[model samples]
Target: FCFKILNFPAEHIMHMAIGTSLSIILVTVTNSMYAHHLNKNIDWNISKKMFFAIVIGALAGGFVSKDLAAKTLEIIFSVYVTLVSIKMLMDVKVERDPKATKDVFYWTVGFIIGFKSTILGIGGGTISIPFLTWRGLPMKKAVGISASLGIPIAMAGVASYIYNGMKISNLPEYSMGYIYLPALVGVVLTSSFFARIGAKLSHNLDQQKLKKAFAIFLMLIALKIFIG
Candidate 1:
């Protein structure tokens, strides 16, 4: 939205790299505390193992994105976003088996999700939840674990962007490398307040309908970006 409509002056990848980290930080802080208080079921063993790899992958992703051309990065990101939106619309049913997997497999999954999270500017939930549930975790547990992983991923992503953009010249005012402070503030303030409301409504609303609507919105955003 910022890049296509508001004409943000920074590279699209840079804006996403910064915005995603900041938003994840705020959302994770609020949601993690809430989930912990409520004892939201989580697979701590897998989560612990994945955390290390996820962090490393996030850092690597940020650095990798920094080196890509703006137009190339934008095209890749738009395609990925479009696919994720389509996945949401599909909303296929998944069963939980609660089986075991090799450490190597878990680490691989963690790294892949983490790497994509940074490039796509997400908290990894979209990919993580499906992967976890497919691997025998309950839906609720998968979501909780995904939320927990966001902390490390966000930290690594922010640090990498800060380091990579530190010496870049001609950034706009109130910018920390790729991070635009004013944009971050606006997003955090609005999302933090509305997120709780959305959660509440989710319990009462038709979830499938909501997901479809959100997916349509994302598709539109992707199309807008692709055409510009």
Candidate 2:
């Protein structure tokens, strides 16, 4: 959306998304931590394990992104988001694989989720929820764990993007590293208001159908980007 619709550089938008997402994530996580009803499903052990591994991966991704060309990042985003959207459209029912959670599974999946989420400027939840649910975790538990992990991933990505972006020259105005302050601030101002509206509306909506609709929209946006 930032790149194709908003006319921003895709790579810089990646950095911008990560930076802005952190603020929204902080609010959500904090609310999750305090919500009494949601407390029962949180597995701190799994969350911790994933958190540590993902942070490491996010750091590595940040360094790698430093040398990646803007055009390359644009292509990467287009392809990856397209694939993810298609996967969402498939609506594959999540069946528990009783043996899916091995001791090392968290580390391995966490690393990949962190790396890719950072590179693509997303919360790892897009990948984490489905993977965890398929791996025998309860859906509530998966959501809880993934939400907790978003904080660390975004933090690591933010730090990395800032440090690396500072070294580059001729970046746009009001950028701290690659994060465009105006865009980040704009997101902060608008996201929370709509998020509340979305949350309230979700209760009355068929979530699966909504997700499918959203996935199709994303695919259209991605295809437009790809064609251009």
TM, every model: 0.86, 0.82
lDDT of 2 by residue, 93-161 (tens): 666655546658889999998898778777787788888877788766776677678778878888888
Can you tell me which runs of candidate 1 are displaced by over 4 Å?
Answer: 3-33, 36-39, 199-205
Report the CA-based lDDT of candidate 1 relative to the real structure.
Answer: 0.72
TM-score of 1: 0.86
Q: What lDDT would each prediction earn against the true structure? A: 0.72, 0.72
RMSD of each: 2.6, 3.2
Candidate 1 minimal-lDDT segment of 10 residues: 28-37
Q: Report the error of model 2 at residue 47, Å.
A: 0.7
